[model samples]
Target: MPDEMALLVAEVFEAAGVLRRSGEAIAAADGQTQARWQLLSVVSEEPLTVARAARRLGIARQGVQRVANDLVREDLAVFRPNPDHRGSPLLALTPHGRRVLDKITRRATEVHRTLAADIPVDEIIRARALLHRLVERVNRHEGDGRIPPG
Candidate 1:
């Protein structure tokens, strides 16, 4: 079982690298990096503090803050005073950011469509479910120490 798990982890890392590269290209179509693209998409649904956005993206808050600052400087997004939290402001996309994000999203959608043309939708859903289960298990006991040898 451990060997199988090790194999799965290897495959997952490889898949992640491939996806990140594709995502970077998609984002570059709108003059953005994948990290900035991710942040913009995350806040598109609703405003969120940088910390919250970082948590959602599973990255460091400091990295998100830097991206948010750059977006603010470029007028792509704006930081609004948070009513819930005085010190931490919420980040929301501006009109221009929305357009950029929309373009990137459309491009990504087309790319994904072409890539998944041969794969069955059911298989994709099953794969996603398995990944989610694995993530959940890892999150639950990630720091509990190494697994015992059988």
Candidate 2:
């Protein structure tokens, strides 16, 4: 049997693959607008400064700025002056953005329901809880400037 650490690593990789595949499937179903979808998805939840959004998305600030600009042009997102930051702006989803997110959420719910139907509901809930715990642990460790030992 694989060592505990090795097993954990493998599970992590597998989970990441599943997430990537699910994202691709969602994108395919919605059409070819990954940036727009991502932007809409984030802004729908809460307003985020461009820099913070870029950091959360793991993309460069310039790239996020471009995407935000496009979203503004399309009337999907609006840039509001950031009272906290001198020159930076916070991005908020427009009404159109909310509508798009509603549609996407419905489709995502359907996909998740179909995918989870074969698994026991309890198992799914447990898995989600575990994943959330893992994420929280990692974030806490990273925030303290410590790399989690492999």
Candidate number with greatest lDDT:
1
lDDT of 1 at 112: 99
TM-score of 2: 0.79
Q: How far in Å is the alpha carbon of 28 misplaced in model 1?
A: 0.7
Q: Write the per-residue lDDT of candidate 2 for residues 6-69, one digit (tens) a residue.
A: 7886988998788777876776675526666787787777899988998888778898898899
User: By how many angstroms RMSD does model 1 differ from the true structure?
Assistant: 3.3
* TM-scores of the candidates in the order shown: 0.93, 0.79
Give me the runs in candidate 2 sitting further than 4 Å from their true place: 58-60, 144-150
Off by over 4 Å in 1: 143-150
* lDDT digits (tens) for residues 55-145 of candidate 1: 9999999999999999999998999999999999999999999999999999999999999999999999999999999887777666565
Report clash pairs, candidate 2.
Answer: none
Q: How many clashes in each structure?
A: 0, 0
